[model samples]
Target: MERLRRRLPPLTALVVFEAAARLQSFTLAAQEMCITQAAVSRQIRQLEEHLGNPLFIRNHRSVALTTAGQRLFGAVDESLERIAQASTEIRGDASDAVTIAATICMSTYWLMPRLDAFQQEHPNVALRLFALDREVDLRAENVDMAITCGSEGQRHGVRMAHLMDEELVPLCSPAYLAGRVLREPGELLGERLLNLDREHWRGFNWAVVDWAAWFDHMQVRGTLPAARLAFNNHAQQIQATLDGRGIALGSPRMLADLLASGRLVEVLPQRLNTRRGYYLAINEHSTRPRAVAELQGWLERVSHAAMA
Candidate 1:
């Protein structure tokens, strides 16, 4: 035990040092590791002390690696990367598959339809999908990849790729909207407004997509009937709208099939841009397996084609 301790620095210190060296910022490394900046600095200091050399030269408001630090970082990075790669290879052999976490609506409305094509292209890869509403920790959950709706602004230790920009518009069955004199946005006041109470709706700013924002955006005044039925799930709200329950603010991509099938109609042709858009997030520490890499490539290609 004593010999081991003498031969090696603490794993925490090594990890902290590696992250700081890779990102070139102690603060960012701290954020990625879910630790304080001070803690990261202390760990790096400890690592430098153990090695009997200065790792970083403190410049004004920034840091630069010393020659010894650069050499050490290269060795440490390669070693850690190899360990991660080996672990992923071991895990991949058991399942020989990729696991993707996505929202229920995305899975049902978007991915399910195109899954056959993906399978056809990569027959050997098994794609397992988890349809969920809540955000998951990829590391803790063992999720290979995840597609979620958000701006890639503040996420750390995850590689985020922008998929598509989503536009929201009010929609209802054409039969339901027929004979309802709706010349202006204010006319929606008398209509039943189905509510989708999800995280995506947070940016609506009116607490609900009521007549207020719609009318305000259209430069009109209107009142909407109190929500008769509210659903926390977007799929449920959309399904309710399809059944002619009420008008719902629908995502263009989510309701594309229903609209094409004549099961639903856009109440207003004008689309509203929301703060959220679909993003592909991969955990930084997790090595992308062969199947996962293939799926990620397919998703990027398909999403880009749809947008184009």
Candidate 2:
């Protein structure tokens, strides 16, 4: 075995070669390996020189694996995958973390507080959260589940569970209402509105769920109050509204605690019953791994309790 090891190709070169062959692009393999394309080509050249056989047939656009390269690629790909699977299986129980991709606001306001409870119950099951406002494809991103906003299941074969259908209403700090006679939804048009600009922004595209839509829902129509302030993210808007900067259209799901604690108050009695709601979507397109199932179950329970 020691003598056989001396005859084996360099593992580093093999790794680069496998990536280049599998992806069919040296540049892509380089990107995946966090190295330059030249580095990938150099490694491949070194491997080919050692083997005394050309591995890849380079062309104008991209490179393709030669017959010998294809045979080697098949073996290396399987070997690497097996190694990874074995490693994962061995470490699965001790460090089985559930990767949950959620909205920035939900992660901050909802998940952060409830995460302790989940951890307490499932001490062994580690939790990994990708808190962002961008859309995440569970399959592409390798996330177990995503907390998403939608009316129905967005992806075929993906399992969807209702998380929260929170009432959309105007929110403001109690200080914002000092010396002001607030009556109804229409009255808020005169107030300094903290808007979530969806027209031009990065992150949550909830512009349709704004004051204009709220007004339409309330059966009141008029020119919207000029946004005294606006934030790209609702989490930021929630914070600004909490500080008494202005009135922001907020959700009971995100601001329920604040609303209950008197840190923030709804400006209008009327709330928008939106068709759009937050959902727990799992990549049931494939096998539902136990670790994913464990976290999903806990999340459903937590969500049910919160919305209850």
**TM-score per candidate, chains pooled:** 0.69, 0.67
What is the C-alpha lDDT profile of model 1 across 1-308, one tens digit per residue? 98987799888899889889877889878998999999999999999988899999987677889999999998888787677668767777346567788888888888788889999998998877899877766754667788887677655456788888777888898778776646656677778888865455565322344445655677765555786888877778878888889888877776667788888888878777766688888866555456677888998998888768
Off by over 4 Å in 2: 1-95, 154-157, 179-181, 201-207, 285-288
Q: What C-alpha lDDT does candidate 1 achieve relative to the native structure?
A: 0.78
TM-score of 2: 0.67
Q: Candidate 2's error at 251, in angstroms?
A: 1.0
What lDDT is reached at residue 106 by model 1? Answer: 85
